[model samples]
Target: MNFILYSDVNDSSISASLGRPEYSYYFVLKAYHPVLESLGRVHVAASVADVDVLYRQLLAAGEDSVFLSFTPPQKTPVDLQCPTICVVAWEFDSIPDEEWDSDPRQDWTQMLARHGRVITLSSHTANAIRRAMGEAFPVLVLPTPLWESFAAIRQQQLPTPVNPGTTLAIKGCIFDSRTLGLSADALIPVPLTPEEEAVLAAELEAARPPALTLKRRFVIARHYLRLWLLDAGRQQIEPVPRVKFLSNWYWEGVRDLLPDAVHDWLERRLRAICAAQPLPVAEPVPLNLPDTSSVVETRVDGVIYVSVFNPRDGRKNWHQLITAFCWAFRETSDATLVLKLTQNDLALYYSELMTLLAQLTPFACRVVVMHGYLDDAQYARLYQAASFYVNASRCEGLCLPLMEFMCSGKPAIAPDHTAMQDYIDDSVAFVVKSSEEPAIWPQDSRLIYRTLRHRPDWGSLKSAYERSYRMATTQPLDYRRMSEAAIERMQHYCGFSEVQMRLSNFFEPLPKVTDVASATDNASC
Candidate 1:
């Protein structure tokens, strides 16, 4: 059988598509390539249109062909001529069963029904589909085959509870909180004097569109006054200003016509009213660094906890990840948290991340932020440098990084929820606690809460950190046992031979037994 594969992202587009919805599908396709080749000749289609073209060529040569779409069911092409199977990675508890935005594909059940067969990265995702599509739905749970890829790293570097000191080199810039001079006060804006406030309000009034009416102007004034009173109340400022309460019914009707300037003014005024604060009128400054591709290095020692994530992705729950790490090891100078950011655009989360770090300041624990691509050597160095892998995500379809580290024999501090349920256990990880919460589908423009995602417990996560650090510092034998268990878990979960056998069985009755033998020599993993 000839296998044709396609994903929205590929090697050429991955850098630009980082943090895009479903961009990780590209990495999934890459991971499956060798395994697919082991079963039959594999061809990666550059575009969706090329899928059918390649399929026809193979068909004309008397070769059976199958198209593997590494994308969500909604994005997969329904018109393809060859047998198509969608490779989905979903973390939500329920799939969208209703249509929205006049797009019928929003209802995943319809798409999966039409596709006939589907492959998901986790049993959680498969169960979600089976729940909507019925238990008979042909959905296979096959995580990306990654265990074999890290064999060299696992062999070259044994897991150690404490790093002697390792220099991690990256092509992008590094930000250390110790060097950042983080100050929560820097995030606050300076209060405006009464005279300055009057001047600014007059300027805003002058800039208002000339068609503005007295009634609309009063509405804006009332809005700001309400805000001022609320701030005063929160700050416990005595002698609050008394303003007549207008019917919110009246305000709601007029709020739509309020100029954008009014909203902007309200934000500025609120920032300027935190009275008696001597802070500058600026938010935390975004990082200024050398070119992203410039080589930078940093050394990490002691008990190091590393986490990789796209900060812009809301499901990452990075706020808790950082804060918990800081609070857990506040007085421990040797504890370090290294965050390897996966997003290309730093501006998206820099200010907020810095502000969060600033709030947890005066702590001896270190926080290091590495932003850029790591070549193979650097990545392996990062892998071996970690004494433990950390993931405080709310949910995960399949956390490839966590699995990768585990495959390299580094244990984790993570939640055994969603996809993690299949592998994480007390034997291998310090399992954090989580609960379900309402969530909307990623593509749902309606923002209706029709699904459920995990909400990781912050206290549980902080406690896990403390416990893991204790294990790393005081219980070397126990840490080693957990490290070995981590590797064993990945080997069973994502090893090449096991994944290949599942894929082969899922796609039974390929052209001939010899066809598989013909491609055996060409398989890389």
Candidate 2:
């Protein structure tokens, strides 16, 4: 069976450097590798906005493909047709539902007409999907993200002397060799011998030298792993369960990049096991976060960073978001919040936002804003350099950039709600209750969309944020704790190995669902 994951590619963190935004798309794509290989070739489509046009292009090209779409389109275009399954990553898919509103997207009455078999990440979303589309519609829960490239990469990076495992070579790539902890002998020369090492060698040679030296650093560091494992073997006791968390550029970029849900479970599980004893501190394994050392993150005095998009008050909220900078001047005073309004930031949203900031807030005069459209390199650096990051929105799918702060070993303050609760633990960052503004933020729309999707009043996001912040900031915002909790949570929940068993079981019996051929009115029409 061919598998394809479709969603907005812009949702991913990798896209700024390589892939698009679709965070789940990347996670699922990465996770499905083994399963897809077991079944057949799996293809994923990032949230391509022009899906219909892209659909036609693919059809014209005659690519034998199957696709898995995430959410349904907002409007029912008569011409909208494609070979895809629309699955809504739901609340029970391991995310809290309280932060979302009951009528998240009730406005899109036309789109529900075209939906096929709607899949939820969990039963939470399944019920919501059914409620929204009527009893006639079908919803299946897909669950949390599957292990992606990181799992394989992990095997390479970790080699306990006792558990000096070997890679069963099936593919070759710089990342594979580095992450899998395989030696150069294993990367290429496709082991002609019956031994797995032979297969690994052939794969490495085929993978070629990485485009970047750092990419090959692990491959080069292979020699050290052998010695470390030797040292590990001499120790009597087994090492603590290695825990970790992964974060990246935009917080949303790496939300599920490391499979944090399962990681979180495993950490608590191991902690429970260790309740009678001491355990090793979980290690923070930050992947694909902003690499400030990279040449791209540099370009002069300041870089403009825009964290807000798709606000309920598109332009007006843009005005309030800019006001955040005014607070920054009094509170942070070191960094600037460049209001990035447009996708490309070409229209100078920062300048206009600054003009508005000047008119509002106590520290308006102290703040200065500029516009120059920050590229990935520049923005990544700014995100890195900032003393703290801020996300004062009403709603969120998962406030990812806060993860960026944690990943970079910096503290952040987010409105306590939505997916932000999933990863940003209280011990790792600052959390604040919801802002008392009249404006509806972008995530609020998603919140509204979610509320409409399921049990709307259930999740207490504002309270969760306040509590989480208290938890994270009880002590000084030490970089060590941030990194430690980040690593611990990431290791326990986000890592593929940590969650593979759960994911495999959940997806083992590929959801057996049929299309809803009919519907009834559940909304106030």
Candidate 3:
């Protein structure tokens, strides 16, 4: 049968050391070539433009396929008379249904339903797709092709020698920010019911200020006041000059200096004061290079992804991560913690963090910071020779770096919250449940007041940190086993065969195609 085999993987020959760009080209070439050779004919395409060219070429030659694989998934494929197959190369699609109300699904179903055949990257996705599409959307599980085409493997280079105690590059970037050339929109205030508001008020009322925290509040207030004054001078604007006390740290310092009973009243007054774009005089300097992931590459004993992407992002912060031990020589004392930080406003907070690290000296000698932007290849080699990775953010969206760690078979530690829980579990990484308070009102590890009267013993936060440290240095780990398991899981759910089978079944029941052009113009709409 004639078919269109499509793949848009950026690098088909992506080395297994690299966790993405599909899993393995060897698997992909093996799966795709056999199908193409056995099929009567196959038109290979990557983009919609390529699709048009291929169709023209086929029509000019008076040839057609009973099947088609739209290279990239989720596009309205140019109307094809033949029952067309559309492939989506994502591991999981969190669609919005009752079960996934926060995700987007109806569009996914519509896109797939329109395509006579739909292919998914993993089994997890296939099941979800079927369930979301009323359990009857014509779909298949063709493993996401690892390689787009073919190539011979190159001799591997020696792993870069990491300076003992030199930090591995640990950076975070928003998933699509750099690629999208965008900054995150400021945090939107979540709505709370009156009952929830009352509870928060009570928590604040019951809370007592941690000692130095008062100084931090004043400092932050001075900060906002400075910005407010700057804008008032330059832009002729005014912002509220008061404070509100709160039990939260994420928005602490500036907001929590006021009494609890009138906190909301103060915030509303502040908003009224600084309604205009409160410019501190200029826009934040844009990062000069691509995000940290752009420079991500696997090293001999380690792999790294970088970028100072998010603060609330728990996935890449500083806590949850594991180490690689394909080699027996790695020692924790010899391991380094390389952190790339820019001194922008949010990153400036890291300056405070540096002071904190110096004061606490927790794991002092082993941690290293490379200030300013760094060389990618330089860091890639550092990562190759390093032991493991970790993040300390309190929240996150899709976590690519942690995935890179797991794909490498290294364990990781993450706060129990965040988007990371979606992929990693007990088998792959450690999830730490922690409270977000210390930075705001100050608290102990057990979600208790640090004072003797309220403080409790060991809590999830402390446990998570301990787990992170342990996994970060775990030697003699089974990188291959971890990597293999991840591969199997991904393949079972997202591999090319899984997608092809689903697509095949989906298209099998569709009316045979005389011509794709005619098919698109008629019947399926």
Candidate 4:
């Protein structure tokens, strides 16, 4: 019954490890440790090296143990004496085919089938695993547990709101071009190699030429025609004119006149043309940012919005979020965006982020980047100063910062997709609309990299900003209601009690290991 918790991010420096994967494991461990303690002894291994040590110790002592890994299965050691459990936060529907050869999870699945079980954050992921592994495979759904520690922090009164139309006060480290090698005062484009320049030029040229063909034109016409017909039909059912007789008659005649073979030909032609279009190439953008210091203790008068994420990951969609925010609030001087980026080397993505921000020039709204080291208290203060939490991510395994913000009684502007679907709703958040878009599986980059992820509609996000601004400024009652609902939902979904119950249920069905030697022998055999 002894459990050894293995997490790679555990060994990371506090500030650096604040990234999603690290802090996610940190919070889960915080929630599960006490519960597991009541069951038996619990030990933590922050790195592979630590896990190796624990594995050896357990083997030598012949102790009944379970290895619980908070990282991907591939990252877990293949050889272990005890039954292993991998907790993963996969955001995609399935692993890519190309990744099958290079992905660590390929071996990890075999390990799981032989001597372990899998735990996922959502049913969406559970379904995906079932699709990949098999319906009969054992995969448990364990949502990321909320941090109960926040209760003490939440007891503190919220900071008073700054006066309208004045600088909103934010106390944190500001990341800029200086964090990397570039000078903050200058707008220098990141130098591109000749090869990179050539690739960029090719991509730009490809984008410029219209790829549409005659078949594509026909396909587009057919699609629009179907949509028009559907709309007209819906209108015809309405009280006033449920039947647009003349229009419907004319369309029906046209549809009858065109043979199905002609439509099929058009479809094939369109497909052929689409298939010929060049594949999108990943090209680096030129980096630029306005002069700013590493530390920011500034004030803003408008409604403050906040979003925290690691810029290194594309799923965060930080670039799109910044662009949408700028476009939404460009002419307004009364709003500010506070981005609390969690990464070890701010310089690694400083240029890219600044370059993205630089594109939103001559804007009235201010963008404040919070980076550098932050203690728990400082982090909590950053959350307290924000009026709303914003996330424009393409997907999430389990967004901890968004959960933490909700737990602190703050309303969010986020899309109700992926893990967020578990808690976000109209009652608690400004739900942005989204559609499935092509993406790469974050893990197993070498495997089927082409996958699909939710793409939030930029227009919807822009409107969310506008609506949230109005709610924060003119509709205090509604805003407070949403804040309260957010806290309530977090408590119900992420509470320690709920997590403990789920864990208890999950473990109850497993056979108890009475003899470590016997279990190890069986597993080895």
Candidate 5:
């Protein structure tokens, strides 16, 4: 049967979509397209908006086709006419009972159950879905595919040890200062003058919204009531008695019933609020580097530790990672910790990262912050120059960077929890201990977005860093063995042959069209 790959991310050019959903899906296309073509013609939608048209065309052609949506199940077009499959990556280990009523994606399981079959990236997600949906729900485990094309860019040579020491440059952006409650201004003030204090107080007062007028309160209540009613209908939840009558009217009709003056007033209030918010007037300075070195340079006998992630994403636990690394190597000048931040705006978090670094002063080890742009070749160099790939993430939804590094024969220092559990082990990585901790579900807005996930032990992570550093420095033979193991494990897990077999098996059970010629003729209509 033919396969129709559909994703909204595919709408943009690959280059513009890096560090986005498109980037991940691009790899999926590379891994699946060839194998799919061998079975039958594989067509991709122009965009997610075009999937409905494509689905209709496929049906008219009488072709045996399967629609695979590489986005969240809720985002899938409800009107599409095809046998659809949703590929999802959920990081949580379980769905709590309390979240069923508030989590935004709570309906995701039931929606997929009704609209299409499910494909998850790991068994953890599959189990969670099964528990929430049902034991008999059809959910397949399809690990994210690593593109073989990356093999061409893999480091051609192994890292050579330097005589005195080496600097490991971690390449990436820094988090915005505002994210860490630091001043976004170029200079953070220790104290404020009387005039400055008055200005600050006025600004703070302006930031607060004016007291709600009785008319405004009515308008806001009506707006939310209409939304709640609509949501209840869409998710099939029982409408509360208070809004039961509002649910009977079309949403547009209910909205029309509101006075035009209310909208105008609301708009004015929003604009006023926006105007009160402070804007940054100056660019932030670079943090934590020696005057002698303009860039991170590689040195011999020096172990370079590297990790790449978005500093703003709470799941990454970057603050803890930096703290642990500093504590572990405080007295060692032979090693450096490199953080490659993936966020686009470096100024957003540079000051905060520096602030965190400042708390670890009087240490011998150097911490480098890589910011701004780098071409693909430049990025590959960062990976190739590293002694080991480290991840202290609290959870993961199939870490692509970790996988890519392993594919290039680099040993890893990572936590064996969440998605990493699928492959991480002591044989291939310095596995840090972790335990469940309460957290806010990143996507949820209700109940203060409360949730739970693994929290990697900082002490254990510090020990891992020390162990990996010692191994890279003194135990060359063991390090080589671990590197080889990392390559072998990643090869088996993400190798093309293995992925092809899995894909083939996934489709074998589905019925196929018996007459391709007849189907083509019908499709022309």
Candidate 6:
């Protein structure tokens, strides 16, 4: 059989597509290529049109062919001539079953139905498809074969509860929290006192915007009142009862009296007035973060925990990962968090990360942010440097970084929800607790909440960090046991032989005859 694989991103474009919606498909496709070659000749098409062109050429030559689209179901071509199978990486509990954005394919059921079969990284994704399509839908859960790829790293670097020191080199920039001089006072100005507020209020009352009319002033006042009341209700700020009462009265009695257009116009004007006001503080002093395109090295020691992710991806939930780690080891000096960021645009996450670190000020535990690509040697060094892998993700579509680290024998601090449920457990990881919450499909332009995703409990994650730290410091034997279990789990879960066998069976002459339960041992999604 001739396997024609296609993804929107290729090696030439991967650097620019680092955090794109379907960028991971490139990595997934790369990992699947060698294994697919074992089954048959693999041809990677540059575009969707090329897929059918190649398929026809193979067909004319009297060769059986299949097109594997490494993308989400919504993006897969439904009008293709060749038999197509979408390789989906999904985290939600339900597949999109309704149409939106005037695109029929946005409803995944239509796309998957047209394709007739699907391949996904996790059992969660397969179950979601089955929920939307049917239990009889031919969906194969195929994780990227990765366990065998890290054999050299595993052999050279044995798992340990602590790292003496490891130098991590990257071609971009690195931010070490220890050297950042973080302080909440530097990021946020001090709150005004009641007396000072009274004086400022009088000055503000006398210096209103020149164009402010009585009606407009009332509108602006009402807007501020509503914002303050909402913030108060959310416990984000202190409440002023009089302002809350007035806002509630206006909302209940006056809001309905105004036409929506007028109300919206007033809100817009209010926003403009607010935007013109001076900020409480000037832009927090730039951290003067490293701005370089050359390789830089940093040394990390002690019980080093590492996590790799694109900060732009909301599913990563990196905010809690940092806070939980800092809070868990606020007084400890040995703990270090090495965040290997995959996104290329540093500006996207720089300020937000710095602000978060400042807010959680005075913590002794270190955080090292490496924002750039790592070559094979550097990446292997990173893999070897980790004492444990950390993931505080809200959800995952088969977290490849977490799996790769585990395959290299590093235990983890991760939530056992979504795709991680297949391999993460007490034996191999310090399981962080989570619960389902309503969420929208990532591609749904209408932003309709059609599915559920996990929300990792902050407290559970913090506790996991603390427990894992204690285990690393005091229980070497137990740590080694967990480390061994991590490797064993991956060997069963995504080892090359296991994944290759599953693929061979999936592509058999009478495909769909293979029992998924037996293939996956009823473990993965």
- The TM-score, computed over Cα atoms with residue i paired to residue i, of candidate 2 is 0.43
Taking all chains together, each candidate's TM-score versus the true structure is 0.80, 0.43, 0.44, 0.71, 0.70, 0.80
lDDT of 1 by residue, 272-359 (tens): 3311234468776556745786899999999999999999899989999999999998899999999999998877877778788888
How accurate locally, in lDDT, is each candidate? 0.85, 0.39, 0.41, 0.69, 0.67, 0.85
Candidate 4's residue-wise lDDT over 1-525, tens digit each? 678897765545544576555466666665667867877689987565665567556656756567788767666665555566877777876643333665545544565555446778877788777876789777777776665767865677542223343232223356432233433335766789999999999999988845456665566566656766667666454433323332333333343455778645644764432122345898866545433334455554457788988888778988878888888887887688888777766558866776676656757776877765566666777667778889999898878788888888788999998888888999999999999977766655354446678999989999999898888888888887887888889888878788778777777776655554555532322
The local lDDT score (0 to 100) that residue 507 gets in candidate 4 is 72
**Model 2 global lDDT (CA atoms, 0 to 1):** 0.39
Candidate 6 CA-lDDT value: 0.85
Candidate 6 residue pairs in clash (backbone atoms < 3 Å): 122-525, 123-525, 124-525
Stretches of candidate 5 off by over 4 Å are 11-35, 95-106, 153-155, 159-301, 448-451, 512-525
Runs in model 6 deviating more than 4 A are: 190-289, 510-525
Give the Å error, residue 498, model 3.
7.4
Please say which candidate is ahead in TM-score: 1 or 4: 1
Candidate 3, residues 1-525, lDDT tens digits: the string is 556555443243332223222333223434555544543566555554566556555655666554445343333453654446654443222332321223332245555656645655445556656766767555555543322111111012221222233333334332211122221222235689999999999999889666546677677656666765565566434543333212222154543445665666655675543223343677766544434433333222223223233332222334322122101112333433444443323353443443434333223123333433334445344334433345445443334444443333334544433344345555544455544332211111234332111111124434544444444446335433443454444444434465456545544554544554565542252
Model 2 lDDT per residue over 272-332, tens place: 4222234679985533322222222112122122243422223223443444444333443
